[model samples]
Target: MIRCTGVRHRRLTIPSLAANARQIAVIGPNGAGKTTFLGLCAGMEEPNKGEVTLFGRKPSEVRIGWVGEFPDRTMLFSRVYDEIASSLRFRHVSCRESDTRVHETAALLGIEGLLPKATDELSGGEKALVAFAAALVHDPEVLILDEVDSHLDEEAGRRVADAIKSRPGVSVIACTQNMDTAAEADLLLYIEEGCIRHAGTAEEVFEHLKETCFYPAVWRVRGC
Candidate 1:
């Protein structure tokens, strides 16, 4: 869970985004502060004004897993299993436990067969999933994914969705451009011009955006 109030950093301003929603999907055009918002949520960056809290504590004080838009930025190991286990190694987890967690997380993300592959040789989507597995390996309290599905195909996206849906205890906040993916979230946030234009159920937000310039015509015609 996360909460923010008048959070401002550079050109972005989040009036508020209440916590407690199980899964939140943030959607907006490019440079709409989606990534900035997630960074603030995960404590990757500081806001010039206002406040941000996760699970009743500041973002920096909480345990959170972040998978950025670029997988290569997070992948340091050559092997898939090693990449996922790197975090556990940094935390000084036992070798046996790290191995178990790495394999389990890979299987959950439908990438178990890739355990022995070379991380640098993976496809774009494969790299993303591996990065996600790394983030999830430590079982952080919250998971924040920033446009992680951008390069993923439909099947890959489904696998990501399944992994998120299966993790009930981990609060998820995902930012994406895909309307269909946003539609599947328990809560939807429509941000425009660095502000939260709407925050509610997916249908409610979609309905509010239907006739506006923000909603994609293709998705609107298909009835999101």
Candidate 2:
């Protein structure tokens, strides 16, 4: 769980947390600062003015597992198994435990077969699974996934959804524009111009969204 007080960016200002959610989905047109807000929640970036905390620790002080829109940044090693194991190693988990943890996470994600392949050898979807595996290997308390669903196809997308629901001990905060994706979230935040303009449960957000002024359908379906 996270709470932000006195957050400011450019002309945007939020005196207190307008939204609090265990599973949050942020949506808005591009440049709305959805990514920026996610970064702040994940402690990947700092708020120029306020305090943000994860389980009571400062944003930067808390340890979190993150997967970005781009899966390429997930690697520093050549092999998939090593890449997944790096988080454990960095946290000083014993070598034996690291291997065990990596195997467990990969198996759960159904990507254990890719363990032997080189990082560059995996397809985009395959690499995405690897990135998620790496993040889960440590089992951090919070997981920040930035538009990860955008990289997946239908079947793979379902698998990602199942993975999120099955995983335990982590609060997920995903930034996405997919209504299907938002439906799976416990909460939804509409970020406009670097601040939260509206927030509610998925049903509430969608209902409000249908009644309010916003732009460019999230998915652009020919007929919805």
State every prediction's TM-score relative to the real structure.
Answer: 0.92, 0.89
Among these predictions, the greatest TM-score belongs to: 1
Q: lDDT of candidate 2 vs native?
A: 0.79
Q: Summarize candidate 1's per-residue lDDT along 1-224 as a digit string, tens digits.
A: 67888888976887777857878899988888888989998999999999999888998887788999998877888998898998899999999999889988988888999999999889999999898889888988889999998978989888877887788788899998877777778898888888888888876888787766656566767665
What digit string (tens of lDDT, one per residue) describes model 2 on residues 1-224?
A: 77778988554466777455668787877888877788888887777888777777886676688999898875889999999999898889998888888988888888889999999998889888899888888877788989988888888787777777787567888887677677667888887776677778766666666644442255234322
Clashing pairs in 1: none
Cα-based lDDT at residue 142, candidate 2: 84
Q: What's the residue-level lDDT of 94 in candidate 2?
A: 94
RMSD of 1: 1.9
Each model's C-alpha lDDT? 0.86, 0.79
Q: Stretches of candidate 1 above 4 Å error? A: 212-224
Q: Tell me how far the alpha carbon of residue 197 in candidate 2 is from the true structure, in angstroms, after superposition.
A: 0.9
lDDT of 1 at 7: 83
